[model samples]
Target chain A: MMNEQRREFIKKTALGVFVGLGAASGLVPAFSLEKTALPVWDEKPVPGKIRWGMLIDTRKCKEGCQQCVAACHHEHNVPAFKNRREEIRWIWKNSYKNVFPTADNAGASKEIQSRTFLSLCNHCADSPCTQICPTGATFKRWDGIVEIDYHRCIGCRFCMPACPYGSLSFNWQDPRTAIVDPVTAYPTREQGVVEKCNFCSDRLIKGLQPACVEVCPEQALVFGDLNDPASDIRVLLESNVTMQRKPELGTKPSVFYII
Target chain B: MKSRKLLWLVTFAAISLFAAFYLFSNGEAETPQKPLARVSVVDSTKCIAPKEFMRANHMQVLHGWERSVVRDGDRVHIASNGSRFQKSLGTCLGCHNNRLFCFSCHSYANVKPKCWNCHLSPMETQ
Candidate 1:
């Protein structure tokens, strides 16, 4: 019995020394992370795996609230022109009648009928802009985002006309002179090139939400992977019957409106 | 003959005066016309490359970064020293702006980079 007690004492003393040494220095990590497992972010957009999409809950989006539109334009350094004709817009509002031509009914609710639908690049799956681009400057990514390579774009404005949604805005003059206080380091577009909403592709690379979506006070915008069944956008689409602008064209627009 | 000699001397004096004015006026101005840089002193850790290297070949490096970012879609630049950086005007322009750092050498060289046509310098914004 004495030998067993002595053995226990030695074991306790060794454990105490081990614990004391561990406490003296952080030899053992407090968080207890697995050394073998390296945390890999790799959030960068990969083609064919993630099809990013958005659902605008129109009910939550207040009329005359141009927050989303203004935020996008500001973030991208989109020019503001005095004349309506010369103005460049990445996102803007249009009446329900204009956005959904065939769907508008005389008997429909006045609230939705008169509602201003936020519009931008549809980022079509089978984008007509990509198909029409002579220089292959406007090409659709495998993840279904239609992006414009300004370097390659000859500024022929072929993609401008091809887009049925009228999302593309051409910079008629140097955009730098227009913005009074440009967003620092944001690229101001040169004259003659067509620019449009890229769905915040730059932000997406760093795993950040779109500026428009982030600025919306009403939480109207829901952006996520359309392919991911568990994504908020997918769940929203499943729960609510959403509508896409001019769906009959079969461009497979990534944006959905919950009207 | 003295009158003709005086006339030639006066003409030479006027020509020299004009030449001096042009030479002095065209030289690099000590005080930059644009807004001053936000910070004056730069530490070695402040920049990715040494100041000498950046001053010499920033254009080439920037163009390469632009191609990788805009065309090839490689946004993040990982340095050999294991530092990761996102290649955008916003990143560097946050500190070393056009008015102070960029134009100091650029205006002196009389080379107009097309970067201003697209990217907004902090001075333009303010």
Candidate 2:
């Protein structure tokens, strides 16, 4: 009888101790939970108030000049592969006809007609890539930028087909060994994951311009808050006739071009 | 004959009870393997969270960070103490670059995480 009473007491005490330990670990703040920090934003954009947009003036773009493209690729440490299929590109130059194959035009200046066009991720407002990503790897930020989380991407390639513009590139091989001098700061992509331009979210956090925008010799690229009527891109769009790639699809490309 | 049957049942019960006690009590004497040593840290005196909590819940934290930042657009994480931290790899890379510590313990435990599919260790760049 004494042994039975002792056993019952021990079981209750054990249960109480287990419950207490669980509650303590879960509800109480863990040690070193204080003093969490992030980079101080000198100019933090108010969420929902700022819509980042870029305006490209094709008239000012110099023919065959790839300064902006090179800067963007180099800055992002985009891996260059001889196999075109394996190439990782942030920005590139193409002919105007190829870039805007659907546009109709008559007798124009050869210089204007033959001008090199810059192509990149449009960062569509209703981005199809983000909509189709199963893992939610590709998502649109509140500031109108289509962002990708590399860790979350499962390389399903659903986003690849969902993208109207051929922007997202899959790394076929380990990109670490391909580059001669790798930019250490930028994370290297592994095989079987997709990547694309994010409009320089890292630089944006630091209150700096995108590498391509800063590298333009003609000052052709204008980036600003499209939501604000007083912003440069808004003013430029109001004054000039802006054309976006495949506007009929209604993706609402944030990057605009003026002919 | 009835006494003989009772004796056999008693012997069997005693053997079973002895086996259970031995099996259950053996764990108390077993020593757990040492966790991997800490890798190079900028400030070894500090950690982002408590050592035991981090050791147990790091993978969960990163997984939550993915949903919080990408899907929900919650970029800044406010700790219980009201301090803010950005959900980023820079925070982890700043301390444990994962070259020595992460791989060592993970390999020992035979659990391979897929973070390297898109992220490089800081040591790899150098």
Candidate 1 per-residue lDDT, tens place, B41-62, comes to 1212256577678768888889
lDDT of 1 by residue, A1-259 (tens): 6435644564677744432332233232222111111112222334456678999999999988998988888888787887988888889999888888877487569878888899889888767798778888887764567888766778899888889899998877777678755665256678878889999986665457999999999999999888777889999999998899888987889999998
- Model 1 DockQ vs. reference: 0.06
The best candidate by lDDT is 1
Candidate 2 per-residue C-alpha lDDT over A1-259 given as tens digits, one digit per residue, 9 for 90 to 100: 6434644554677744432332223333222211223533422334445568899998898877889878877767788887887888878887777777666656446776778788889998777898778878887776778888876788898988888778889888777667655554456677778889989876665457888899898999998878777788899999998899878877889999997
- lDDT (Cα atoms) of all candidates against the true structure: 0.71, 0.69
Model 1 lDDT at residue A100:
83
Which regions of candidate 1 are displaced past 4 Å?
Answer: A1-45, A104-107, B1-46, B50-56, B94-98, B122-126
Model 1 local distance difference test score: 0.71
TM-score of each: 0.71, 0.71
Q: Pick the candidate with the highest DockQ.
A: 2
**Model 2 clash pairs?**
none
What does fnat come to for each candidate?
0.13, 0.16
lDDT of 2 by residue, B10-126 (tens): 999999999878644422121222222221212222455777788899889888876765555555554555545566665665555333445434543468887765555533544
